[model samples]
Target: MVAFHASALDGVARNPALPTPLLLRLLAFDGGGDGPPRYAPQRAGLPESAVAVILAHPNPGARVDFAMSKLAEPAQRARLVDDPSPKVRAALAYGPEWGDPRASVALPDDVCARLLDDPDPSVRTALLDSPHLAPSFVASLATHHDPAARQVAARAWEKLAPDERLALLTDPDPEVRRVAALGQCRRDAHLTAELLRDPQFAAEALRRGLLHRADAERHVAERTHLAALAENPSLPADLVERLAVDPDEGVRLAVSLRPELDETRRMAIDFTVGDLDRGDGVHWVREGLADPEVLRRAATSAHPLLRRSAARSPHLPPDLLHLLARVEDPVVENRLGIHHPDTPEEVLMRVYARLGGTFSAWMAETHPRFPREGLAARYADHPDGNYRRLAVRDPAATPTLIERLSHDPTVWTRQAAVGDPRLPLHRLREALHVPELASSAGANPALPEDEMAAVLNRAGVPA
Candidate 1:
């Protein structure tokens, strides 16, 4: 309302899981701002009333932003099918659940028919490569006029029948053949030997099951292919030993972290440990986590990233959690505190005490085991507002300290205080008028039912 601030809209967007109608009024007031629409507020699974607010609006930019986000239904998003803006139409081509890796949303059949032949070539291209598409849709693209579209069909080789796969693999387009080759190599092992000798495809070919002892011996020294060979789960054990001593420090480093190697054998190898922060979870780890043995192996891995990944499992047992606690990395300790229920109070304190728990304040309030006794007294007088904010976690916190923090200089700490039940009702009401504090204050469970409804009424919702 005050010069179209993004926070007014994004505060609702950032917590899409909340059953709230705030996004409706914010978008209604702003008309979705200038230029292209942002995606944050339009996430899939938002309440129908919130989604209707945007869908019922006439703003092309708002509709475009909505197209790029997850949707409540395929038909809901498909309403934008004949939109005038080419960009809006193109955004719809990305289909449902845009960035979600675990689930794909299938567009309604009627919508898919329209988008398949959209006037904009760019839209058609996006539809061709869109996630959540069925295999049959990809198979039908095998003979599309656009070679790029045909290339997308080729990548879906497993989904295609043998004859259909052969047609795309033999397509006249060189690039299409290349994109299809890696997948096809897995289907036909005999073809791998030929591809292995070709420099253009050798690295990919080396990772296949077709790579025998002779193949490993031959390509083991090819520096370009070492990383691929190192990644191959089926790589020969003797070859693993040979690569463990390879001249390339990168190869030796990779071999040292192989999950199959015992800690003693792995530590004995001379290798440079990679210092970059590797991110959480590998696909293989997720696939194999069902087996208790796999989880135990990954939890105790010499690779720090693998251990960090195992720490994310809610099912991780106590002994493994303790084993990870001994790991020297502070981030690993934070992962434990964030996920595992059995993570002890001292470990949580250790992580927050070291890292200030910058992005993970939820633990202080909701973690069942977080030490509540004396929490307020320990941190209420701390000079660092970040640490002082911990006082709000205790229900028995003195009213004087809660009042002081409700107006703390740091916004994060201030927001936390505004949501605490110990905060005076008058201060919580005051926060509802402050633009930056309104969303958190509105969501506070401590706020009375009628007062919460009144706050929503002010935001233009029916109380």
Candidate 2:
């Protein structure tokens, strides 16, 4: 055994791919089962003779190690069933051998039965990880004193009879019940009714169309279930219609966001003119006000809030959009800029003129319909550096204008100038000499490869 450990260590040091049989032989001789065994020999990789030698070892620790080896035959494993050491039996009961199908002793009924009665909680818990564990054994674990063991048993829910599944639904352990409620057991009305009382199961119950209208209503009334109830396909249309006008804004908003919207249901939710014109309230009504007449009323309302909300509707007539565009309120103008993408060039020009140089005006100027001619030049000398930067980035920027900005004292403008695709390669090379522009100029794709290398070399940066 000492020779085998030394030879195994030598083989590992030299080849590193030393076979499992050699390693298991070394483990059998190591005398180190002070804690649970850590390694399981692969059955396919180790010869049966090696498994026999380890199984017959005088050291209980060696027997414990061999008991868990996947290579141990069922009859050989059975011999350890009554072994004097609990640790050896425990190792046999919960080891990798039970989980692997190719292992000769994998999930044998007798072995599982023996482990089930074993005092070790770990052995019982480990038994649950077996895919081949019988339903009867799983049923026996349902009443396990350990909550964790009961939870593990709950995972075999599909294999449990309906009566057995129903019994677990009322299990003292909430986790066990949670698992049971989500299992494949028949979700009859009784089970549904019982689960509906718990918020955790209520959402899933609603999703599966298990709850009746009265039960669903009770669940939805709770703030916790409002969002889930909205998403529940089983929610009755009448209830959905009722929920649309629910006093809770959150509940109403949840209803509004549902994927399917029928016309009657749409009208029932008051997102239109008569509803309170709260700023966020507009979002709830946005989808409902699809009619052109409703949108026009909203667009023309005395309240700028309603008008701003109305401006967001895609159905608004062009005339209403033109009118909203000319409204002096910055909020209304900004909303128009965002929602009125198809605004006529004349209206955009008029809005830009009225708004002066505000962000909304800049948005108008950047619109594709707005004339590009002289636009960049107009903002090029604007006092705001942001406008100047935008002007430098404009497609209308001329080579001379780009070069002028390249020498601007502002580092950002200079950076923008160096980044311009139209900057001549020769000008880019010259700009590299300016320390501030050097990094940006060097990184520019237009800079010649040789010149980029020289610049990087001068900066002491490795290629």
Candidate 3:
């Protein structure tokens, strides 16, 4: 009899109750009978029989694992290596005996096969991490109809032969296909080149290849593949278009920003921005939105993302805001800052109001080339109070308009009037006295104190 204690598990075993000799004999063997054993062993000094009873006891899982881990002998430990209970097997797997093939017990082939099929994924994960798992066994797992097993096989693929690795390239599962793609990228260069040339596989392969290779040969191959893929008319147009719109800003910038594009092709793709399939919608929205011809085409495109992209075109001339104003989509309409007669006065007013600060701030932060003064002046006299308010904030805002809006009943209108940079200091002082206009003075930091003061005076406040 002995008391067991270790630093690793802290003091969990310090006071464990020791099983009686009779109970220990029952646990150490499969054959058993009958009921409660009498007289448990004394709690402090545990006998070897007590340890055997603890390892084999059919009670809670935690207790079984704790006891098996405490066992130190080979024959006793081998007794559990293939225990029918996965919990018992797992406990053995986690034990120090796991690394010693000499201690390995022969697992039933059927049991190993069933474990390979376990619906629980972690069981298989444990299998792969085991030392020198047989390649034949792993090969069977790789082709397993179960997507999870195939994925596991795909990961530890260096052990697989080229053909065996290539077999998974068309796996039914997307994740499997992705993993197979990674494996394919490394082992078989010929297959990788084939994938890079196949339009269907080129995009996915290129995306994965970039992660694997970086030297000059790989770079040249990648460029040559992209340029060749770009010209393949038989390739799906949408995929090609995606290439044209590659999320890599560098790629998008390259196509649209290229100075070498012939005027004819550039203009042709520009005009096609609205052509349902040929519409260089992405590049058009990227570069052509400034041209009226381009905006009209983009405004009519059926694609929503393209339409949204078109709306963001900042290069549109001032006079074109009227045409863009007619776009039915609010997303595009808002981006164009249209103030047309058909546009609801409310929306027009919001657009105008946004121009001075909210609009300008967003533009400067996200899209730097937004032309501010010219656009604001175009709508200075808009009938909507919101538009009038925005006009007042523009650097181009006039004194006469400031004086008129200072008296306007709408608080927002009065605020805009008081914030006008064009208003004389006396007029701004006057406007500041009006209670409704007072708070409007400091609302926009962009509205200089001198301009706000001029608006305050115009509203009849003393400055």
Candidate 4:
């Protein structure tokens, strides 16, 4: 509801470019209700004056919002550490939750260090969740009075020294000891060998550590063991070969998808693939990329799967793109058309026309390369109403056509039309009454500043 927050005023409070004087008043402004401040403290370009107002505001709500905001300069962190409310301090201590406005910002390390010694247990507990803690601090968490904190440190057991890891193995807490055992088994071959003798620990060891060929071979008769072996990225080439022809179809399918194999070898394996989805689904999602030769060979490979894999490489050189373009696969075109920097203008349009409603098509429709010249005139009366909506993107689109499209039978076409700055002011105002277009109208850039302030005034905000 627009009435939910006093300053909610359409989206003005969310604007990063609002002048500092107005922003200060909004930060401290309380309009008789207890709703949290809608004015986002994390919005960029906040001046020091705005920060000072947020810190001194009588309402703790705005202060808490600023506490979790990523904007605090390193020098300003100490003041935040001393915030009057524990709730605010806890917000500062813990990183923002996923949907919080502040989640994307980095809280300074100095602030985190100060919060490490916070008197409140809640504040201390929140600190443990923050990834920004210093390495030494995480290592010392092993001895924290709280067992929960110690258990968290066990997850980072590799950071501990050899003697420290040994100490954790014998810790009084059984849960801590169990988590630590995985680390120890992976680190010490002798301990791993001992643990393998027990069936329970052996299964965990297979999942967590690289296995010698003899140990790996010992487990292959069971379908469950073969599945684990094929799923393990650490499985050596010889182990992959041994699992390749195992009687279980699931095991072979798992091997076929492993990062180590190319298209030809994968097709030769014993499994039948169901749906062939994006080739980059598994390994290419990581920071490290497939080798240049792998990508090049895949780009030129006869397998549609390999070509799709090559298209997923954002760093594909021009030569590979040229090769893949000739292949003309829809999946390959989807990946390259929207994501690759060097995709041709013709490809962008073709992808937009062919792959409608798909993620790539949406991206391609808005892409700078899609020709904008006289687009409104060309697509204005297109039989497909969806295509007529493309006119809104053309700079040549007249206010008259924008007005006509604002009443389009296709609802999205109308919503997109009203959002277009070229839509006449009268039509944009009318859109505010249509539920579907209300949000789009309120956020429309064409809504003049004074008109926005008037809307806020009517909504109960003081001038």
Q: Compute the lDDT of residue 172 as modeled in candidate 1.
A: 91
Which ten contiguous residues of candidate 2 have the minimum total lDDT? 7-16
| lDDT (Cα, tens digit) per residue for candidate 1, span 386-407 | 7778888877887678889888
Give the true-structure RMSD of model 2: 20.9
In candidate 2, stretches whose alpha carbon ends up further than 4 angstroms from where it belongs are 1-210, 220-224, 271-378, 393-396, 409-411, 424-427, 433-436, 461-463
Select the stronger candidate by TM-score from 1 and 3.
Answer: 1
Answer with 1 or 2, whichever has the higher TM-score. 1
Compared with the true structure, all predictions reach lDDT values of 0.67, 0.59, 0.46, 0.67
Pairing residues by index, what is the TM-score of model 4? 0.68
Candidate 2: residue 187 lDDT (0-100): 49
Per-residue alpha-carbon lDDT of candidate 2 for residues 1-463, written as tens digits (9 for 90 to 100): 2332322222221222334443444435433433212232323344566556555656676667556665546556656766777777777766644332212345566677777666766566556665545566676667767666677667777666767776787888888887776663234556667666676777666544455777777766655567556655557888887777777765665565454564444445654333333454353346445677667656665555557677666556778887777765656655565456676665566666667557667767666666555657776787755446556656788888888777766677777787675787778877666556655664465655455435323433223
How high is each candidate's TM-score? 0.68, 0.38, 0.29, 0.68
lDDT score, candidate 3, position 20: 43
The total of clashing pairs for model 2 equals 0
